[model samples]
Target: MTKKNANTQALHALGQSLWVDNITRQMLDDGTLQRYIDELAITGLTSNPTIFEHAIGKSTAYDAQIAELSRAGKSGEALFFELAITDLRRAADLFKPIHAATEGVDGWASLEASPLLVDDAEGTIAAAAQLHRAAARDNIYIKIPGTAAGVKAIEASIFAGVPVNVTLLFSREQYLAAAEAYLRGIERRIAAGLDPKVESVASLFVSRWDVAVKDKLPKDRAKEKGNRLGIAIAQRCYRAYRELLAAPRWQKLAAAGAHPQRLLWASTGTKDPDAPDTLYVQALAAPDTVDTLPDKTLEAFADHGSVGAVMAPDGGDAEAVIAEHGALGIDDTALAAQLQQEGGDSFKKSWEALLKGIADKAERAGNAASKAGLA
Candidate 1:
């Protein structure tokens, strides 16, 4: 395999896409997003409420729009969507050519619904469809968490012709569940006489596994094994993905015109400052999968990156490494559950914070307008 960023590009050459796990208005306004697409081989983007909260909170670029939307009676979630959709649409358009170029295999942008409904299967599905339709862009995906209820929602969303990006997955099991949901949804489409090839991707989170286990064990075990845990988990999921693609059940779906649900690596940034900056990028590089890097990580890889050997087709030593952790008294299953739950909560918090920021900004804008007699 080539060195770091070289390996990342090699992975892309092998059919996997490198996506940035972030989005921002400035990225769009200043052409940074376009540059990433052009130079870094990043083909997609993903965003959550936290990303928006930070983008809007620490800047004044959105204040004028908040003021305008506030005057138009939009506030809170409604206002948030208005702003988010605008940015996502711009990104979707930028990726539209790639979408068309790849026949919808690449060039996608993802926006998640409110995280508060993670357990509300129907509600999550409803919100995902509503958001996707509102965006009016085919390359845009509605992100759904991979909770049990979320799996249900994912299946239903795919059946209803909504492209989905499954988020918040922690374990190989959870990733498989998300994949099953995507396939079931597509099968339902074929059964219902609808086109079954709605594009989708299942995003398995990396890095956080190391974060959760960092302090649980002694020095050697707890010491960052660099990207060992995350890359292992990802490798296992990729093996399963390859099996699913080759399975007889899925083969029938493909025969009927359904697209395979691609695997995506989420949260690819290193949690350990001491680890190589591109640890996740270098180790988890594989074909037909995705590694979604944060902005800083992208720059790091672009500048001084070298991808290591290609991930093993049989997952290399992932299971044994996981077993080593298990021997150290870590319950991998329970931790996966905990990580997923926390992931859901984390997003909900960000969503709430984003809404609060919007509300506050709108209020301030409203006052400014009132004082200026622009109201």
Candidate 2:
């Protein structure tokens, strides 16, 4: 209802849930997060290793807690989860009203499973269950990658009643694979007479596709193809998402109380400096989908972005656009695999750095506590 953020409110009015892609304890403490919810129609949030690395490593807000946890003999992943879950629990509580009002359709917060378990299905599954249990909140989603192994874990985790946010998806095929896994899990739950309303969102990384192919474009065609791949891919995936929901398979599950796994647009922040700041946000607006925007993009959209026509359910021009890029030597399939692998690798690196940063901080905190005779 705030006049200043009318653009964002309009988008929400279109039935798309706008979720912030970053989370930090500082935002929670300072009421910035709450203001976004109140003014900008932000209904949900998500966090990953990189976001945590920056939040914990770059800010002193978490130092005292890290110190206390260190003093209690928690270190490494155990210490990190304590900090993460604490922040996410606060966020989840803030969104609890939205979650309840939507009957669990919106107002959720996501914390990713360990990137180190990207290829370890069993490890990912166990970690997801453990993290979900630890968070002890129904609205908190344990993010799992959509890797070959992760796909296996997704089905099992969903069957186990852990709401999953499937991350790092890049292509229509990959998205379908993750969706299939979700369907299988829900099917099993129905067969076993368990609750079939396990919620989920399959995240498709948009800007990363453009970032991956930007430099590879032919010089003459660069201008023409600069920032279109990601949108095209998203459009294609959105079509699949729409079709999937209308299928008899999903309809049956729906009758059995299963919720449709919403398609989420991730990595939506414009990576190209030349592209409009709110390019992805404006382009991907549609009903029944979630678009997770970075802080800058969210602010930019709130200020000046206009919602265009919603995406075509039939994927208008997406295939032709994809073919154009393909003819220029960009292979969508291979690139999707490469992007996913690179994304997993990048997150793994961040995970290592995050753990190391925590260890270093904990050591400093411990030494300081000892010097003060409190250890």
State, as a TM-score between 0 and 1, how close model 1 is to the true structure: 0.96
- Per-residue lDDT for 1-375 in model 1, tens only? 323345446667877798888887888999988888777788999998789989999888788788888889998888889998999999999999999999988999998888989999999988998998899999999999999999999999999999999999998899989988888888788778898879999988889988888777778746644347777888888788888888899898888877788888888888788898888888877888878999998888888887668778788888998888788887889999999999999888988888888898888878887899987
lDDT per model, in order? Answer: 0.86, 0.95
**Candidate No. with top TM-score:** 2
Report how far residue 300 has shifted in candidate 1, in Å: 0.7
Residue 146 lDDT, candidate 2, scale 0-100 = 97
My TM-score estimates for the predictions, one after another, are 0.96, 0.99
**Residues 251-312, model 2: lDDT tens digits:** 99999988899999999999888889999999999999999999999999998899988999
Off by over 4 Å in 2: 1-4
Candidate 1 ranges beyond 4 A from true positions: 1-8, 224-227
RMSD of 2: 0.9
